[model samples]
Target: MAIKTWELDSNFKNEIAAMPGGEGIMKCFQCSTCTVGCPITELEPSYNPRKIIQMSLLGMKKEVLESEEIWLCAVCQTCSERCPQDVRISDLMGAIRRIAEKEAEEGKIELKGVRAIFEKAFMHQLEKFGRMYEIGLSMEYYKKAHGGFFAGMMAMQKDYQKLGMRFFKKGKMGPKSMFPDKIKRTGEVKKIFEKVGE
Candidate 1:
């Protein structure tokens, strides 16, 4: 395969470098530790964490920024754990996600299906109960992603019962309520996000 070199704008490099975990791209040696440690790469070759860093270093911002593959990363932390250079692969991906999310906010990007559904469910939970109710959020997310009853029928047979039990259990609480003090702290965090227009 011929390696493609993108002609990226200098401002893009500066933009990415200013991100929290994006500053170490220039120091990478292509050791491939991040690649080898990423579990998702085993199933999806397009998600090479090391290659992501290389693309970032080369300032292929468009390709990197427009990717749904970055969203597929579940942040399992294996890549970060195995990185010999101590590069925070999860954090770098988070920085990239912020860039993509900013573009999404500007209407330049449109998230499809699961991503949009997930986002809506997440925000709904935050706005309604001040934290995520995992079971409730999951059901809402599934319904939104599947588009209605017919699409989720098969999945429901396998997982819905379990999730419903969790959701309706008398003693269950949302993630925030599980820790009394953390709820207050999370409210403070939400205030900070609101201040930043998040």
Candidate 2:
């Protein structure tokens, strides 16, 4: 985390401020309100919103963009509600994630965790079906996460078996859930995704 002069990009903060949802980046005044209010920070001290913002402002572009911490945000907006500066910290995190995603897409960096994988799976379901298909999403996520369907099932078997039984008993999951019908006019969903450059 050492601040090497050569590693800094002086315009990095401005770059973030110019992005949608990141317009308030310049408003953070090191108040630490976002960190204090972040529920994720409470359970995982390493996921520090304040530190990420500080790093972003300091022009630590590589560190911030490559961080696994940015993807950990739950997007609950507690920090935004509590910010004295109206920084919209939750949205700021989203902005950062967008940038990270762009970087990964362009091959500037490799994303390092299941969060991104899960998001892709979730979004694929929405784009393809115009709504969530829980069984399909789970299968896709597991397949991508573990490299294959059988491998993923084996990895999650014990815990998922118990959970699956509970869900079945409660009528939350069953064979009927496996064959979810796609929403009418699913093309609209793809159009929406395309509009957002997804």
Candidate 3:
């Protein structure tokens, strides 16, 4: 068995350090507090904040940016909360996500499905009733992603079924429940993203 080595660029660290909240990645001392604090790790074995920081520190940009683990993060803030160095690990992950998106647009990366799912799911909510309608968004997301089998199966869970029927019966599709005023900000958010690229 042989271990393959990735050609890490020397400038990668400097580039990542320039992103917002990225400076703390360099200060991490491998205390493992972050890994212990992350609830996602309990569910998803691949979701390790410590390894992510290590990769970032080593300038493994390709691995860090292309990982589904980054997007799967629940943004629970526990990693930062438990850090002995007070590093903002969650924000660092967010910076990596932004960089990944930029890399994707430039043809340097190909994480299209991740962006597509997120955008379509988000836009469906924005266009329909303003903020997220859990049932509607999940249904639309599944229809587009998995052809509804997975979503349908998940919806069959007792709690999910109860919630789904309640929402369906209540028909919570209005201004008060979904925040109609927030609908106008969708374009603004899009424009902000546009400027971020420019």
Candidate 4:
């Protein structure tokens, strides 16, 4: 990688520390323990937890905030568990993700489209039904993925039709399963979701 001078914001660390679970970044040393424990790094050699923290501490704001490395983390907490410094690596990653979201909204960085769309769609499913509705969730996901209801339905027809037939034959999952009886206290669940406010 070619070196570029960082337009470092000295306050960047403090800004991240202000977010939930980010304070642990300050406790991280360049020990590489986090990196060693990260399963993602084994597959994605570039997804190094130690490098991420070092870059963040150096205030490489644009690169760190915009990196796919942050999003690549599986949040399994192995890094945190293996850390000698008690740096909660997974939580720190979450903080970085939150910062990425805010930066995207403020137009400081480009957002990852599919990741954001599916996150919203999944959360919408949670808010809409008290429990997960797989078919509804899949439809919502496809809707967001394809950009509309009709288009999404048409797209699913090629494959979901086959899957639907299999589900029906097996009496496993299909239309009836998808549209199961909603919880009578769905209203209460809605209230809880509203209180959480996403």
RMSD of 3: 4.8
What lDDT does model 3 reach? 0.71
Taking all chains together, the TM-score of candidate 1 against the true structure is: 0.71
Residue 70, candidate 1: Cα error in Å is 0.4
Which prediction has more favorable lDDT, 1 or 3? 3
On TM-score, the candidate that comes out on top is 2
Per-model lDDT: 0.70, 0.86, 0.71, 0.81
Ranking by lDDT: 2, 4, 3, 1
Q: What are the per-residue Cα lDDT tens digits for candidate 1 across 161-192?
A: 77656764754545644332225556765676
Clashing pairs in 2: none
Shift of residue 33 alpha carbon in model 3, Å: 0.7
Q: Give the alpha carbon lDDT tens digit for every residue of 139-163 in model 4.
A: 8888877889989888878758998
Clashing pairs in 4: none
Alpha-carbon deviation at 172 in model 2, angstroms: 2.4
Task: Please give the range of 10 consecutive residues that has the lowest summed lDDT in model 1.
Answer: 176-185
Instruction: Provide backbone clash counts, one per model.
Output: 0, 0, 0, 0
Per-residue lDDT of candidate 3, residues 103-134 (tens digit): 88798976634445655576666565556666
Question: Each model's TM-score, in the order given?
Answer: 0.71, 0.93, 0.69, 0.82
What lDDT does model 2 reach?
Answer: 0.86
Per-residue lDDT tens digits for candidate 2, residues 52-169, read 9999998998888898899899999899999999999888988888888888889987776788888889888888888888777888888889999899878667547788889999
List runs of model 3 lying over 4 Å from the truth. Answer: 1-6, 112-116, 119-164, 171-198
